[model samples]
Target: MGSEKQGFIWLSGLLFLNIFVLSTADVHYYEFSLQESPFTKLCSTKIILTLNGSFPGPEIRVRRGDTVFVNVHNQGNHAVSLKWEGVKGSIDGSNELIQPGRNFTYKIELKDEIGTLRWHATSAWAAATVHGAFVILPVATEDYPFPAPTSDQTIILGEWFREELTEANQTITPGSADAYTINGHPGETYGCSNDTTFEMQVDYEGLYLVGVINAVANETMVFDIENHRLTIVGQNGTYTNRSFTNSLTLAPGQVIDVLLLPNQNVGHYYITARSSSGTHITNGILRYTTTTTSF
Candidate 1:
């Protein structure tokens, strides 16, 4: 048997791909509501449209061959619909549009072999906050090609705009965002008033899996962890020929799975995401855990 525990993280609209081995197929039910909530970004706070009152919403997990039914309700004034990215089939062969004060049910089947994907509102600007991770696990008969890691985590890369996007004639052009964020925070380096940042703890000589999700609305971004090399394992829910690189490039709505083997000197390292065409940068911390440290 492999490691049974899984971890999830969200950035703007990014979703982590973490596959598990399951014994049987099952049906999963989920409720998603489109509404508004007060969110802080780039040193400012405002009410933004959201899914289930969260910026990045919730994580959906299922086994291969499982069926998932998501009931989405639009509480806001705008019409909304959700589209699953990297999915093999359509949304029951129909468009899933939920108007204001209306509800729609989305039926999706996990027919793909295995990988990470995401679900987001098809309506423009709604995806700015209405998105989440969709994870599909392999069947119990299958196992990962590589050795299972001791621990795992996810990193979601995204952008944040300071102005309201619901206004008329608003669009996400280049330079529309005030800053970028990792797991919904711009980190202390960006002068975020909240001073919140994403942190990953590791142990010496431990192998870990890091799922990277690029949910940036408009720009391709680069991801790197200081003093480490990432071994590419999968992309967009499909395993690929393994490779190694110091950094990764991801366009919007792309997901990559990488293996992190921490053999360097134990300390804190910066996990950075920088926009390829813009000056926006966000950061997280990767801290090595010692016997005396709890994080």
Candidate 2:
């Protein structure tokens, strides 16, 4: 009999495409949300800001020879300015400032480094919300010399505000303390029944390779999967934490990759992530089914 431990079942629906597998040449341009929050929690915060909404927006996982384009659309009340000067490759540092209801495009070619990275607004007014992750995976054709997952999912942790961003920034006094949020809101949303709505969803079941990117707050997240095993991968895109277990501190701009093997049986499960602050953010789902049967 094959050892269950030896069989790592992966969900490929979320997997990168073959064209992106090891292709030395590819081009992709992402759209940035200057108006709407990429996350749903903002629905409760009732706060609308200049940020994209997702803690770290979508992970741009690509291989070598990829050209990335970012089209930023300004939807907020304040004018948006992005100074890329501090960004490693940004020579001038200042990309064009996007005005309200306007858009701008940022283009760059990928080098050979494979790791996680972030793109944030240089503007003081925008940095509070305009942040996301940029990931460059090793060339696809190259053999990954590790126990990798068959499928993957992403979890983003950030703060949400219902109030207008302009109002929040103006009210925050220069010397006063600033509140850090996870997913979008603070601890949880208040409800009349005392059942404050808080927390995000994590997928349960099957084999899942998960990536959690914290964009705004510094959090030590504990991911609990019911009856499953987990392994930690790359951190900060450079620090390698291989095959380990324990809730680790993930500061802003950090990414954690873990593999999970769920309890046996073809079913569904929820992957849960909770911040040390007791804040809940994003959620992902996993479904298991026999190959002999259609999903």
Candidate 3:
């Protein structure tokens, strides 16, 4: 992933792609509905706007050079704006407001781009829940720039607030979240979250591709897993010289791709995250598959 400025919008009933001219490329189409969903966290249930009823939403997966068309239905009470400033092709997929009950479509071309990126609401506090990963895999003719892992997962780090979202038109300030979350759970470290903490089940010696995104409202997060080394292969969508580290510092909206090879004893380990300068901690569990020891 490198420079990505070629994303364009196809307006319905107004603008359309010249299908005849670009019929050879693959097209990926998706529908996203911004609906009101009840979200309960830290022992309180509140109504929040979500994409397809999911806090972290869904991944927009496509191959390099493929075109993606996302048709968004804004069913929430507030207007929405989505932004995706990705790599290499720099597909700055920023759009004007899609008012309540209105629908719009977004066209993104991932030409010459590969790796991890993201899209999130840019209007007021909508991004707190309406966000997801945008992944561009290598084109059909090419393989990954690095060794392919046996499995893959996406870890989205986000902040949570206990305060009920204000008016739909108001921007709720994220003044030091009530807790941080991994893939939507506040982990088990918080009160009333023990049973809901996210978990990763892995083989004892599996090699995995882990995509980490710092989606905290406004904080830099440091992420680490106990007894495991994160072999960073890419940062912000571009491949980098392989580097190993125990802790990774990620600014808001930054993405990291790492290879996690579990070589420790087959039990459980802790995947932890916290603000770079905060006292609170969030933790997820990494459990290795269990089996008879052939004793």
lDDT (CA) per prediction: 0.77, 0.53, 0.79
RMSD of each: 9.0, 9.8, 7.7
Question: Which runs of model 2 end up more than 4 angstroms from their true locations?
Answer: 1-23, 36-47, 50-61, 81-88, 91-96, 122-129, 167-206, 218-222, 239-241, 264-270, 277-295
> Taking the candidates one at a time, how many backbone clashes does each contain?
1, 24, 10
Better of 1 and 3 by lDDT: 3
State the lDDT of candidate 1 residue by residue for 24-120, as single tens digits. Answer: 6678999888888888766678888888887677888777778899888889878777888888876763464677998888888776546577777
Write one digit per residue (lDDT tens) for candidate 2, span 141-161: 665445555666655555444
Considering lDDT, which of the candidate structures 1 and 2 is the better prediction for this target?
1
By summed lDDT, the worst window of 10 consecutive residues in model 2 runs over: 171-180
For model 3, residues 1-295, the per-residue Cα lDDT tens digits are: 1223223332331233333223446899999999999988888888988899998988998876688889999999888878885644444435588899999888787655567888899864778788899887665555666777788888999877777564453564444578888999888888684337879998877789898998876788999988999899887766788999998999888999999988888889999999877856899999999533545
lDDT winner: 3
TM-score of candidate 3 relative to the true fold: 0.86
Query: What order do you get sorting by lDDT, best first?
Result: 3, 1, 2
TM-score for candidate 2, please give it: 0.63
lDDT of 2 at 207: 58
